[model samples]
Target: PGVTRDRRYGMVDWPGWRFRIVDTGGLDPSAHGILGAMRTQTLRAVEEADVLVLVVDAAEGLTGVDRDVVALLRRSGKPVVLAVNKVDSAQRESALAEVFALGFEDVFAVSAGHGRGMGELLDRVVELLGPTARATSDADADADSVDADSEQADPTGEKSEVVSSGAAADANEDPVTDLALDGEAGDDDDAADADDHADGDDADNDNGHVAGNATDVDTAAAEAAEIKRFRRPEGPIRIAFVGKPNVGKSSLVNRLLGEDRVLVHDMPGTTRDPIDTPFSVGGKDFVLVDTAGLRRRRSVDTLTEAVAGKMARDQLARCDVAVLVIDAAGGATVEDAKIAGMIEESGRGAILILNKKDKVPKSQINSKIDETKEVLSFLSWAPILLTSAVTGAGVAELPIAAARVFEQASRRISTGEVNRFLEGILADKPPPAGPNGRHVRLYFATQAQICPPTFVFSANHPTAVPVSYRRFLSNQIRQAYGFQGTPIRIVLREHRKKRKSAPPERN
Candidate 1:
């Protein structure tokens, strides 16, 4: 019941309405320490939220804390919907009478865990949100319906046809033509014909010219639309802020978001759950996850802290970018290096944030960065920024840096471009002889995947390739492609040759 230590935001999409649902920490007015800080955070949420859903435990009845929270909500002058949770069965519905004493007009006996009586509760909550929300929702639904109808009525399928053709053309188009490398060939005749068709019609008459112009216009429009769709990111980039306790992770999040979205106190482990808050800066969207501070396994005393640590590590794995927030005043610690190592292992784009820079004297800022680099030399590729959430210094550059890193991670190098780059590398410095004194020949290289862009190299003896050579290739690729702030993977595979069959013997 005490798991949630901050406000967790989730979006609710109904048939015609969409709303944001925020789950806040348990409120105890007289409590001290972390629990007291949680109460303060809940009060801030109560002040900002348009509607409140007060869930009281039906089994425990209305406690003093519930009554106090209710009093606080009433003072905020916002709509409150009382949900009596844990009403699992019809027999348990009788417990609502006790909760009704809390004086909430819209009380619904619900079972959150069992999924009982939730529909009615949501209906009441949506109703309390009033007409403005419904109007916006309806407008969005109408636009979506219009788009669907337009797609359905397209009998010619011109849009789809052009998109497919454009994609084919892009696939076949050789961006690098000057480099003559093996296994790199020109576009086939069909692709050439498609390109010509897109360029213009093959007729001399005035009518034909007009028709060609129209076709050219359509092709250009389709190509632009396809490019836009291809470039659009799937969703908001999720950047997880992780570090040891009291390293200013939550403070940095609050500073970046320009609000106290999560509870922040001097206490270590003040934040528990990974709070995902949608944020946008410089025309790009991102989800800033403020995770609980992670401590060593030996130091984790309580079960709650252990769970929080696990959750923090899990967040680090799923995030697009892991921002390791180190305490600048304290310098990088053993725990900080461990977290940075975890980020490297996860293969996610990373940024090092030296937080609380104000606490570090100006004269020692450079020295502190050098000290941190020495401790975290394993993650030297990750860009480090000196920041102070208290003074809003160097916080604005965070999202910009994250966007650049994400772009680098998501970048894809075509096979021809990769092979051409490989050719240049081979000419500069070929692979060294193996331990068996046999020459290792690298036939070709191609990108297998992206998002921490993975490249596969086909060689005569893949196993004989040394680690130093692999590192050299990776460094060269990064030097050529600017894959900074992200790790690039190199995979070697044996290039198998086709064997000739003994036809006479088989007969």
Candidate 2:
């Protein structure tokens, strides 16, 4: 019943309003262990959300847990929208009567699976959030009006001319509007023409006179462009904290965030869902995702744990960087190695965090790192940091290290630079001969892509090139370019010779 073990956030935009929705774990008053942690997350969501939607299962009817949840929400003094989910048909509408007794006013019978009665529920939510929604819409409209006015009042002071010409061009070029007019069979076209004429009349009344002159318009446009350029936000680098359960992934996240943003428990698998919290360090933005600790697939006993494991693995694909936390005190296990392999396969920038550093004796730190490295040998390129969430040792360096790794992954080398580096390296250690003792001639090298910098080499026999040679080239490239904390891909392509066409035969 407690599938959502953490707060999951999403944004929904309607015609005139936009709002955020938070889905929380099911509530249970008598819950302990993981369920108690879920209750904490849900209550936190209740504290933060503008409005709350309490979904109840119609088939199960009302229960003690539902009543407890209602009481909990009532205590928060926040508006609640009760949704009687799984109410599939009109016959189930009678079941909604039981829910109204627990609620203040608004309640709806909804079939979430079939998408029934959701609109009324959403409408009621929007109604409750009307004031904020109206403000947001008004702000957006004001911004749009400013942009339109800026476009219309250009350097030439031809505001009306620009507006009319642009409108005419749009009317002529828009196929969708034309199809709509055709569907109306000229009735709507007359009204549209009337509206255009009215707009043109209004433009004429303005006499094409704007307050700003050519110089002013140019200056304003430049200022606006500069402002927009400066204000444009860069997408935050998403970093997922993952490892075997109870390795202190959530603890590390909490340490880095300087708050308990994610739940940390002594019990394993405390965090079921990937919790994404936006954080900033030294002016750079990042989304720190604390994921469910992953165990071996066979070890995943419950369906919920299986789903959680899947979700954690899925998070690796979405993140730019992965912070693989291992228990430094316990040493890296085979499970940790498997998780590291997953990150490498996902092609994400990675950082190995040997957390619980405080527990490990300071004398054994280097040995622990070496042992972990031996187990996770595949991730040798990934930087490793020993951190302790409890003592806050090395926690501050996590984001900085992640940022550096991200930059390294996103680094691109020029073709000329690549070729030069290849020339120098090939001379130092030439490619091994093909199986038939034929020489493998290397033509040239170029960077094919970035964000996990990939290099392509053109050769006479691409397939004949050995994996050892590819590894050698990768190592050389990394050494030359300092692709630290990121994996570099090497590809080989055959340099095909051009075949001359024979003269056409005249018959």
Report the number of the highest-TM-score candidate.
2
Candidate 2 residue lDDT tens string, 1-507? 445556565445556655555555667767788767766766666666667777777766777777777787777787777777778777777777887877468887877778888788777877877665443455454321212211111111111110000000011111001111111234453333223222221111112121111222222222222211111124778899999999999888888877666777898888887877777889997888888989998898898899889988999877889999999999989888888989988878999999888898889999999998899898899999988889998999999999999889877665445555765676667777888896776654555455667676666678999999899989888888888888888777655433358999999
- Indicate the TM-score of model 2: 0.78
lDDT of each: 0.69, 0.67
Error of 1 at 338 (Å): 1.9
Score every model by TM-score: 0.76, 0.78
Q: Residues 1-507, candidate 1, lDDT per residue (tens digit)?
A: 566667654445555665555556777777778777777766666655667777777666666667776787778787777777778777777888887776778887776677787899777666767653444345454322212211111111111100000000011111111222112235243233323323233232222111122233223223222221123236678899999999899999989888777889897888887877667777897878888899999999899899889988998666889999999999999989998999988888999999999998899999999999999998878999999999999999999999989988878776546656776787778888787797777655656556667777766678899999999999999999888899888887665443347677563
Error of 2 at 85 (Å): 1.7
Structure candidate 2, residue pairs in collision:
none
Question: Model 1 segments beyond 4 Å from truth?
Answer: 13-17, 30-33, 88-95, 130-232, 498-507
Q: Local error of candidate 2 at 244, Å?
A: 0.8
